[model samples]
Target: MKPWILGLTGGIGSGKSAVAQHFIDLGVHLVDADHAARWVVEPGKPALSKIVEHFGGELLQADGQLDRTALRKRIFANADDRRWLEALLHPLIGQEIMQYLARAQSPYAILVSPLLIESGQHTMTQRVLVVDAPEQLQIQRTMARDQSSDEQVQAILKAQASREERLRHADDVLLNDRDLAWLQSEVERLHHFYLSLRGGQV
Candidate 1:
């Protein structure tokens, strides 16, 4: 049987990872989209070969792996390239995500993605969970954690779905303006809620 999928998403620095970690600690399987994206482009994968063919072999490192930093610069500058890359990668990533979900033994598994809403991943889930914070806090935290410039972080936020749009799709919401202890407690509430929904004793 397909396990229930609890899709978790948030903007940069909105604490999606922190919330997902709490769920992970409670034994929920984590099928991370970012990890699946990378997996689809591993050295032996067909997706990697297609990327190298289209962008040139220089996109590969001396070790014959993708040079993600270089590719990010190119794609960000050109919309056509971005679309082409997305067309190549998204399907492969989706397959990997489905495979992980199939093997998960938890009452449910969480598919954690920054682009869950924008990439249409929420359609595959039983519930959409948004980890949200104010836009300013998102900017501040992303700048600190990623060592990114304000301009860079702001650009990323611009490309993502607006905060309102994310909230509009949420079946559950985690407001992450407080400390870690508070976040953990809220996660506990949601954890039990999920268990209850699945008809399991918690």
Candidate 2:
């Protein structure tokens, strides 16, 4: 049977990864765009060579790998640079994600992407799940998790689609401002819902 594909998205530090992990624990296959993004740009990959050629070697670490910190700073400092990078990387990431989904073996698969809404890839899925929290909480969590400054976190948030925009597209919303138990219950409920949908019981 073709697996049911769910596009899971959320603002930075809204516990999207934690929620995806819950699905993984429930035996749902997972395809993470961030992981695919990283894989496509690994040292020997074509994407890496293209990035080095376009952005120059300054964006590379001593090991000849992409220096994410340097690249992030450069991209955030200029909209044109950010768009240029996205134009190059987004298609590559999308291709990798599609490949993973094609081979997914579980009853259903979850595609976790921070840019799912903005990139329009959510259209490829049967369900759109959003992990949501207040902007202040999202900012705090992001700063704490990444050890980034408030300004940097805000910049990243500004680059992403707003909470309302994401919620408008959601088929399921998981409020992650509370405790893990609540998150677990939501995940379990959604798992069953997705299974039912896949079984033509929707």
Candidate 3:
């Protein structure tokens, strides 16, 4: 049977990873879109050959791996490039996500993606969970964790869906302005809640 999928998303630095970890601790299966994206473009993948063909082989590293940092800068700076890359990769990533979810042994699976709403991946899920934090907190946390400049973070924020828009689509919201203990407790609470929603469960 197809497992119930809970889509988890949040803005940059909104503690989505931490929340996802808690769910993992409780034994929920998870398929992360970011990982799937990377997988689709790996060295032997057809997607990598197309990228090298279009963007030139200079984007590949010494080990023949795609230089993701260089590719990210190129795409983010140009809308056309961004659209082209997305068009090539989203379907492949979606297929990977579905395959992983189909193999889930848990009561439910989580599809964790930063772009769950923006990329329409939430349509595959039965519920959408949003992890939220104030914009200032998001900026600060991202800067601290990623060592990114304020301007870089701002550009990423601008590219993403607005906070209000994300909340509008949410079936559940986890406000992550609190401490780790509180976040873990909330994850545990939601885990049980999700288990209760299983197809044959009362």
Please state every model's RMSD to the true fold in angstroms: 2.3, 2.3, 2.0
lDDT of 2 by residue, 18-86 (tens): 999999999888999889989999999998998888889898888888999999999889999889988
The residue ranges of model 1 lying beyond 4 angstroms of the native Cα positions read 199-202
Q: For candidate 3, give the lDDT of residue 2.
A: 65
lDDT of 1 by residue, 17-49 (tens): 889889989999989999999999899999999
- Total clashing residue pairs per candidate? 0, 0, 0
C-alpha lDDT score of every prediction, in listed order: 0.90, 0.89, 0.93
lDDT of model 2, residue 22: 93
Off by over 4 Å in 2: 143-153, 199-201
| Structural similarity to truth (TM-score) of each candidate | 0.93, 0.87, 0.92
Candidate 3 regions with alpha-carbon error over 4 angstroms: 199-202
